[model samples]
Target: MQWEIVVGLETHTQLTTESKIFSGASTAFGAEPNAQACAVDLALPGVLPVMNKAAVQRAIQFGLAVGAKVAEHSVFARKNYFYPDLPKGYQISQFEIPVVQGGTVSFLLGDQMKTVRLVRAHLEEDAGKSLHEDFAGQSGIDLNRAGTPLLEIVTEPDMRSAEEAVAYAKTLHTLVTWLGICDGNMQEGSFRCDANVSVRPKGESKLGTRCEIKNLNSFKFLQAAILYEAQRQIEIIEDGGVIKQETRLYDPDRNETRSMRSKEDSEDYRYFPDPDLPPLMISPEWVEQVRSEMPELPGQKQARYTGDLGLSEYDAVTLTASRAMTDYFESALAVAGADKAKPLANWLLGEFSASLNRDDKTPAESPIAPELMAALVKRVVDGTLNNKTAKVVFAALWEGKYSDVDACVKGEGLEQISDSGAVEKMIDDVLAAHPGPVAEYKAGKEASFNFLVGQIMRAARGKANPAQVNEILKAKLS
Candidate 1:
């Protein structure tokens, strides 16, 4: 029987705040196992939790960026659970009512635009880490991360394939980083994904039982986990076995997900409003303030690039893929004139991109600063150097062989000879020498013209402007 794969994602985005959500404890990564944990994080006797205003502001910023409704009042609920890592025995999270109510996240899957409807993005605290390694059959608990601020963004089951799920995850990562709300670093656990995967008959309307794969940090792992889980469910159903609703852990080494525990619904957690904290409140003025302070979104920037700057949609999309890329392009544009936008785009997307990949550095980290990039492209625009010579100058700048573009061109003598007289001399000499080919041209061999043009450029040691060589050579021949 034909089967259809369904997927949804719950992304935990650690807010870019210096402290934890409910305490003043430091949220910096790589601290000693318990060095950063405070009394509140430890759930000490008579200790109370206090909300971080910065975290709330970040949530509001995210809400505004996604066009979600920022609720005027939201409440924090205690999710009762027992684990060594969860010191409080109950995690403070938003339930019944969340801060960011509803929105849509859209991304490109190949050439088609796919949008995943957002159920809610709620604020919550993260649990600490459990260390099972480097111990003699004993487990260690680290509470430093217990109170970290996280915005749990939940999506509906709208994705149909592993590829689509990956695309959605990438788009969400970019958005969070672009908004400056989250660092979006998967390696450090700043961003984590829980994928709910299931499979049903292709024509079936009702959803099948889903098994949640927990804590997929990388996009590659997410794709692999979803593919494996979906196949597992399909096989079970095909064999007349029931698909169980449970939480599973993906083993990247083995490339499969193993059942962790039975998945719990809202009721199973025994959620209730926290007594220590009152209902979180927001006002229209506050939402407006955050909205006013929001940066121009990626979609807005893409539209401006295509509609106003006359860039192709593909170019606009490529340029705005990340904040670093867009900043680099704009910084170079600011240095180079607006009239050279197309030329600058070409260089940025082509030579610059290839160089960055080869060097394994981001555009922001490139040794050739945007100003220097602009200087090189400007030389090309002004005909000081042709494309070939401009690349030579670019390489020299990247290698730190020369500091200024003009100096590099001058020191290397790489400038194109655009002077008509200089090019004419070279062309005249070429015509005087290559008589056989010149004769062939007069005998109506059109290829001979190209041959003579190459000879002229060679005679000038490739410094002669190509356009000048072609024009003067044709005139002398005529």
Candidate 2:
């Protein structure tokens, strides 16, 4: 029997607030072990937790972005648990009523659009880190992240393959970072995913026993972990063994998952509403205010690029893949004029993208400024330079050797020879000098025509406008 994989992702997104969710402690990353942890984060006696207004606002912003219903009233519950890093002995989180509910995350899987239904997104405090390294047979606990704000966005089991799961993760990452709510930095643990994967018989209505892969920070690891976990479950089922539901950890070195512990259910957490904190209330007016402040979402931008800008669907999608890239393209387009959208898009997606990748930089980090890029494209459009010569100027601009497009063209002597008279003179010289090839062309040898054009371009020292050269060469030969 064939098995089908099912996946659901629970993403913990660290809010971009300067302080922890329920405390005044700093939320900045990479501080000394416990320097950022305050009395509230340390759970010291006589300390009470206070909610961060910025964290709540960010959660509302995300809710509106995903078209989810932001709850007017929600409750905070204490998730009772005991771990070395959990200073409070229980985590403050949402239980039955979360802040956001019933949303969908849509992404492109190749050319096909796939959407994952979100169950809920709740505001929670992140646990601290347990350090095992640099200690000899002992562990250390750092509570700096104990009270950090996180939006736990949970999704339904809507994915059938590892590729679909990865696509969903990447789309979510782009959206969160675009919203400015989260940095979406997997390296710093700002955004982490826990994938619940299972394998069931094809066409079966019943779900199989699922295992949660904990804290996959990388998309490549998420995909690899899911694939490995699915195969592991399938092999067990095929061998007439039962699949146990547990939490597993992915070892990148081995490319496999090892069971950490049995998976726990809601009942296991012993959740109860906190007495110190009142019911969280959100007004309809507040939601509307947040909705009004939201930036144009990716979907909205994609539609506008295709409909108003007349860009191809693929081009629009590629341009809107990241906020930084979209900003770069739009800024260049504004300077280059609206009619230059196609060329601007091509440069951004083609040469600029390749250069960025080669240098291991993002569009935001590129040396080529938007105005400079616009100027370069404008020169090509106005026939001041052909594509080949324009690239020389582009290289000089990228290397910071030239700040102005015109200066670079003049300094390098790479300007296109667009003067009709000058180009005609050169072509006439080429035809006169190459009599044998010209005679062969007049005798119906079509290949000689290309040879004559090459000679004319060589005569122009490679700066002649190719289109003008071809047009004039064909006319003179006729």
Candidate 3:
């Protein structure tokens, strides 16, 4: 019998507030160790915590974005735990009641739309980091991250495969980034995921023992880890061995997972409400204010691109994957107009993407202006330049040395030769030089026609318009 994989994700997204969650300390990344920590962050004596209003507002904004119920009131709880990174003996998080609950985030897998139900998203403070190196027989602590605000989003186990899990993660990442709540930089730990995975018989109603994989920071690693862990569990069950409920870590080098420790349940943390901070309250007016400020989300934009702009679903998704990319695409389309959307989409997805990848830059960092890109697309569509010539112009624009697409085309002499008389003469010359192939074409050798077209293109130094050349060749040869 086939085995089905079940997966759920708990993502921790660090809020983009200017200050720590419960302190006035700066929440800047990459600061000197202990530099940004305040008395409250250090948990020093005689210091009390105060909630940052901006952090609370951000959580409300996220709740609105995800269509969740923003609680009128939520309490802060102390999750008691002992760790080297945690300056305090307890972590300030929400328990018993969270800020947002019972939401759904919809994403597309191929052509089908799927919605993953959200269990809860709560407000919490992040712990500091422990550095093991650069200290002789001693570990170092970086309190810069202490007291930073985070939104712990938990999703129900609605995913059935590794692909679905990765897709869901990516969709969440895009939504948060587009909403400007989080930067979604997985490498910087701004966005992190802990995946709970298990396996069972294809038609079974009961789930097998599930293993939790922690600290997966990349989408590729998340997919790989879940795949490996699910297969491992299935194999163990098949061999008469039972799967263990434990925490594991993904080793990217070996493409495998190793046991870290037994997984801890909610009771292990010994949660209790914190006495220091009061309950968080969200007013209806505050929720309405944040909802008004939210920009158009990715899913909405994708639908508009497909229905209004007449783009394919694949094209719409590709264009709306990132906010910057979507902005670039729309700006280019505004100049290119609706009639040129398909060609413009092709250029943006093809040459524009390729150039950005080659330069190790993002679409946001691209030096090419949308107007200039629109001009290049116009030239190709209007037959002022061919595909090869447009590529040359694109390179010049990417290099930042050229002022505009027209100047690049003129400077490189890459204009298309559309003179039908000139093209016909070239075609005749090729056909006359290859009498055998020309005779073979007349004798029903269809492949010889392609040979004649190549000869014509070669003779014209690739500047000839391919379609015009084909038309001229067919008329002359026949």
Highest lDDT: give the candidate number: 2
Which pairs in model 2 have colliding backbones?
none
Estimate the overall C-alpha local distance difference test score of candidate 1: 0.91
Clashing pairs in model 3, backbone N/Cα/C closer than 3 A: none
- Residue 24 miss distance in model 1 (angstroms): 1.2
Clash tally for model 2: 0
lDDT of each prediction vs. the true structure?
Answer: 0.91, 0.93, 0.90
- lDDT of each residue in 129-155, candidate 3, tens digit only: 999897998999898999999999999
- What TM-score does each of the candidates earn? 0.91, 0.93, 0.94
Candidate 1 residue lDDT tens string, 114-144: 8899999999999999999989999999888
Q: Candidate 1 clashing pairs?
A: none
The reply for model 1, stretches above 4 Å from the true place, is 421-478
Q: What RMSD does each model have against the real structure?
A: 2.8, 2.4, 2.0
Of candidate 2, the 10-residue stretch with the lowest lDDT total is 383-392
By TM-score rank, best first, the candidates go: 3, 2, 1
**Per-residue alpha-carbon lDDT of candidate 2 for residues 369-441, written as tens digits (9 for 90 to 100):** 9999999999989888887788889899999999999999999999888889999989888888999998899
